[model samples]
Target: MPRLSLALSLLAVLVPAAYAQEAAPATSPKITVDPRAIVDSMPQQGTLLTGLYATQATIELCSVEAGEPATTAMNAHRRQLESEMRMDDATSAAAYAAIKGDVEKAGVDCAEGSKDRQQTAEVIAIYSGAGATPAQPASPMDPAAPAPSATPADPAAPATPATPAQ
Candidate 1:
């Protein structure tokens, strides 16, 4: 009877210990996130043009580090944006230079398992074909109709141009 009780006690302790060992979560590798780095990497301006330029710069940096998948995704995104807002060669170059400079200043590092690298992958995934729908081009205006005001109702306000039909 004593042996039976001892055996039961051992089993109770061992079973719970074994279960606890199995239930414990595995430790994951530490990931450091820098808020300043994240902020620095972001687009300086809220304009669509700035966003497009930032995307291009991100692609350029990620392509070299993250490889072909990044390149493919970024290129597709670039094409989509370009189809919407066609920029001339000089403008494109200038925009790229400015964006690239900001990115460089931000110290973007696309090394494997890095925060920036993960962010780049996420950007590629999100901005690639499936994520955002392109804006529909405005319909052609009837030339005979009176021309709409080029200036805003408030003279001090800047005029926002209608999106050109693609």
Candidate 2:
């Protein structure tokens, strides 16, 4: 029937228009990180990644197989971790020792994060240097414009209104 066809046509046009209006997000979602999750996951060392990468970095100098003295290696490892984790020397040493023990006990080179790492609270927010925010909805008065191309625009083309002779 004509009524059915008209209703279908109206729905097709209306639904798309409604979706287009809400397509843009108002704000970007902030980064959320769970400490336990980060410790459990393994990250490939010497790899490059952008944004808030949830990767683990461990210092295994405390292992007996290393040719260095136990205290010496531990101190060096603690120092490295302190700088990396932005923690004090004592806290960093404790954190490193905690992980080192876990790895050694398992007779393996890697281990997951342990509960002894008291430094990690239940949840934490991590901010990566690479900034990425969700696209915001365009204003009704002014529509959004596409990014400019790499090639320069024509010099003669006037972007703004021509200034009257003063």
Candidate 3:
């Protein structure tokens, strides 16, 4: 019985292959998806979702140097994208997976780091809903880093200098 079943299955496969070979001038149209078509047909906020995927993919690629900021940025983007996409956790996760697949299939690399906070066109084109990037570490020489207070510490000082020493 096993042998018969095996033979039938082989015959079934072969018959279809043979018929397919004879049936068309064109080879089977590759069932490939067009990145543009996929992006264009997405529902509102889909682009942002794709951007989220791009960000995740980029962060993963940059994992060797990924720091707290990158992680925070990725998380924040995810939350916003989730809210905008209006999907439950599981569904949003699946949607992100699909976006990753589509972006990868289109040969867009998401792993490169930005000197500045601006996202790449490929990322933006697919999803422009990113409100902000994560905060990077304060540079040692960066003026943005707060300077130490000029005033000397005095625990006994009054609550306010404006008030008399009461």
User: What's the residue-level lDDT of 61 in candidate 1?
Assistant: 72
The C-alpha RMSD in Å for every predicted model, in order, reads: 21.3, 21.1, 23.6
Task: State the lDDT of candidate 3 residue by residue for 53-143, as single tens digits.
Answer: 7667644444433445445665777787688767798997787677767656766543445431235433433333443443487787988
Which of 2 and 3 is ahead in lDDT? Answer: 3
Stretches of candidate 1 above 4 Å error? 1-49, 62-73, 76-86, 127-166
Best by lDDT: 1
- Candidate 2, run of 10 with poorest lDDT: 46-55
Report the poorest 10 consecutive residues by lDDT, candidate 3: 116-125
Candidate 1 minimal-lDDT segment of 10 residues = 129-138
Candidate 3, which segments miss by more than 4 Å at Cα?
A: 1-44, 61-64, 108-166
**Candidate 2 local distance difference test against the native:** 0.43
- The residue-by-residue lDDT of candidate 2 on 100-124, one tens digit each, is 5654564543323443221111111
Order of models, best TM-score first: 1, 3, 2
lDDT of 2 at 76: 52
Give the true-structure RMSD of model 1.
21.3
- Which digits, one per residue and each the tens of the lDDT, describe model 1 over residues 69-153? 6567656655555555566667667767988899889888867778666655555556443442223444458454456776668
Write down the TM-score of every candidate: 0.38, 0.24, 0.38
